[model samples]
Target: MHGWLTTPPGPGPHPVVLIIHGGPFAQVTVAVSDETQVLVDAGYAVLACNPRGSAGYGQAHGRVIRRRLGTVDRSDVLDFLAGALADAPKLDAGRLGLMGGSYGGFLAAWLTAHDQRFTAAIVERAFLDPETFLGTSDVGDFFVEEYLGPSRALRNAQSPQELVDRVSTPTLLIHSEQDLRCPLSQAERYYFALKRGGVAAELAIFPGEDHELSRGGTPRHRLQRLELILDWWDRYLPVRPAPHART
Candidate 1:
């Protein structure tokens, strides 16, 4: 896996936030990320990695996770974080949080359900249930079968909603009302299951937005998204002050 880590200017340990990019086949480049900047400004060490299924790494790397959504990609992400933490002692592994959108959101939900290490998670505009996603998403007809394979059992096995019974991490689900690519029900059903299972969960549906809300929505909604995201992280995995700071 290839990635980047950005941290606030300091020589002390800092809370870490793992960010997973949307496309299972997309890559995370070294560039100015407004979101990461905000989180860093709020005193976080942000880790963004391009795992096994990401592009710009070659064809084999991209195809390695085909019909294998949660396995290799999951390993790559965890391993990347592990390596990051090991190499950078200044990143506090104990105060870890995760957030992702689209396919990245699927992995975020999948990881929180399987791993108990993260303090909390933000699942935004996720592709959670493969079965339902087939019928609802704009590209579901071929995308589901192409990626998950043409098997009902396989889809369920890889579905976060179906396996949400195992999730314990506090989660915040965010989705747009007009996201045809992922759709709103993706977040709704997962939120419902999280609640029924007694996990700390919250769902926020944007009134007039779509899958691109974070990138292209009106400035007002985008700012609102940033605020809510920081709020969730602050409540769940707050950044501790530098030791010498005065109140």
Candidate 2:
């Protein structure tokens, strides 16, 4: 796994946000997003990584998660995060949060359920129920069989919905109303489940948008999305006051 860690200047220890890139086969590079700078400016340390299934790490590494999906890829991310925290003294491990879209959102939901370390999560344009996604999404069936095999039980097991009962992380679900790729129902299922289970959760559905809402949605909506994310983090992992400057 490869990644970059960025921390704000003049910080003793800062709350950290793990930014996971979408695309089960894509890689997260330093040039990929300005969101890292956004988080840094907001007084948080950011760690972004390209785990095993990500591209640019040889074909074998990228294909390793094929037909295995949630299991191996999740482990790779968690392991990478552990190593990153160990190496970065400025990151506050206890005040950790996560944000990701699409496939990254799937991982975020899974992590929220399986790992209690995260204090907050932003699951954007996520795929929650594999069976439903396989039926409703544009490319669902193909990717489902390609990543999770043809077994019904296996697909259900890997679905985030299966573990919804266990999730306790304060979560925000952002989805586009017109998205056919992951669909708004994906967010709906998880959001409803979280609320029913007494978990802290919020849902934001953007009008006239699709799966690309984060990347290419309307300017106003995109700004609103960023504000929502920042607000969630501030509420859960509020930044501590910087040390007072000497006179």
Candidate 3:
């Protein structure tokens, strides 16, 4: 229910991208990501939502988000769209986009599967299978125990893998080859499902990098990856009235 919004300069009917930050407990808004500013500068409206589960809002909301996961947070997203965009007359509803990494990615994939409101999505190093996560990720057991309770069945019920077969939006999956936390296989499996479902999906695996790539990396590579994301949005989720000026 709490977040920030950014606008592109000299814009009318600009596209909007919903930025979902990672962490079952981390406050994405406080952690800070250059992508938010960059995307805003690129002439798109940005709605950064720190929903119920986010840490900054307090402990209670965080616990609530963890317990319900998709059920509550998904509705939060829907409400966000209703309240946040209602004031922006230039916002393009048909071109709505979702971008998230790690936990955010899972949410994005979940939204893609549960709803058709989004036209495009960018998922980075997303976790798909909680059962597999317990095997592959170093911190999986901790999160599973901390957030979703101790039940294995409860964990699977919240995982994106369980629902990816239903996703229809065009999605771009990006993960680092060196990502030990989420692993490349995670993205691969989701990408496979997207393709199998006859959905438009593309996977980008960054070599010699880890989960930290999105947070900080060589300037050139960082810009390159960011550009690839923007390009993907432009290609598939272009606004009805394209901005007249683009660098």
Candidate 4:
């Protein structure tokens, strides 16, 4: 339920991006994030939040999302953003972007599907379909069963792909071809569904990379990833020009 918001200089109401962290079980601490810096430099405010399911908040908080992937954790993220916006008048509520990797991407996809507040979203290395994840991912079977239960029906209920039909925001899917933790098929399936449903969507697959591409991929690939993300935001949720700079 805690997070950090980094804003660009001379912000009078800058577009904001809610950046979620991977490992629904991991905690996001205050640190120098290269992506956050990149976004801020491009005139976007970045809000990195650690919700209920995140670690370092005691065992009970982290376990609350067990068998409830998109429930409380989803609410915590939106609620946190609401509170953040209310407190920071310099952040525009209309132009909001969402991006996350892995479990974070799951929540981002889940939220944009149900909530129409986001101007755009980037889903990277997401665990989208629980049923397919059970066999494809290195930890799929245990992770899905443990977090979503073993029932096929229950798993489908929490799967983000099931709700893809409802998404209206333009979305970008970024994935690694060799990701064993969340196979490339996850992004492909969602991309196909999104396009068929008439939503603005694009999928970018990086070769020779895995699930850890964002954290451990080669420097060149990582730079490319950053450029891709920035380009997506620029197209869909562009930063408004400052009043003084307006022609």
lDDT (Cα atoms) of all candidates against the true structure? 0.93, 0.88, 0.81, 0.92
Q: Estimate each model's TM-score.
A: 0.96, 0.95, 0.91, 0.96
RMSD values for the candidates in order, in angstroms, are 2.6, 3.4, 3.6, 2.2
User: Using alpha carbons, what is the TM-score of model 2?
Assistant: 0.95
Q: Which stretches of candidate 3 lie over 4 Å from their true place?
A: 28-33, 239-247
Candidate 1 — which residues are off by over 4 angstroms?
Answer: 241-247
Q: For candidate 3, write residues 167-217 as lDDT tens digits.
A: 889999999988888988899888888899899999988888889887676
Is candidate 3 or 4 superior in TM-score? 4
Residue 132, model 2, lDDT: 87
Best to worst by lDDT, what's the order? Answer: 1, 4, 2, 3
- lDDT of candidate 3 at residue 77, scale 0 to 100: 70
Give, for candidate 2, the lowest lDDT window spanning 10 residues. Answer: 29-38
Worst 10 residues of 1 by lDDT: 238-247
Tens digit of lDDT per residue, candidate 1, span 167-221?
9999999999999999898888899999999999999989899999999999999
lDDT of 2 by residue, 1-247 (tens): 6888888997558898998888888988768466788889999998888888898988999899887777888887888889988987888888899989999999999999898999899999997888888899999879889888799998887889999999999999999999999989899989999999999999999999998887888999989988988898888888874568999
Candidate scoring better on lDDT of 3 and 4? 4
Model 4 / residue 164 / CA error / Å: 1.0
Better of 1 and 2 by lDDT: 1
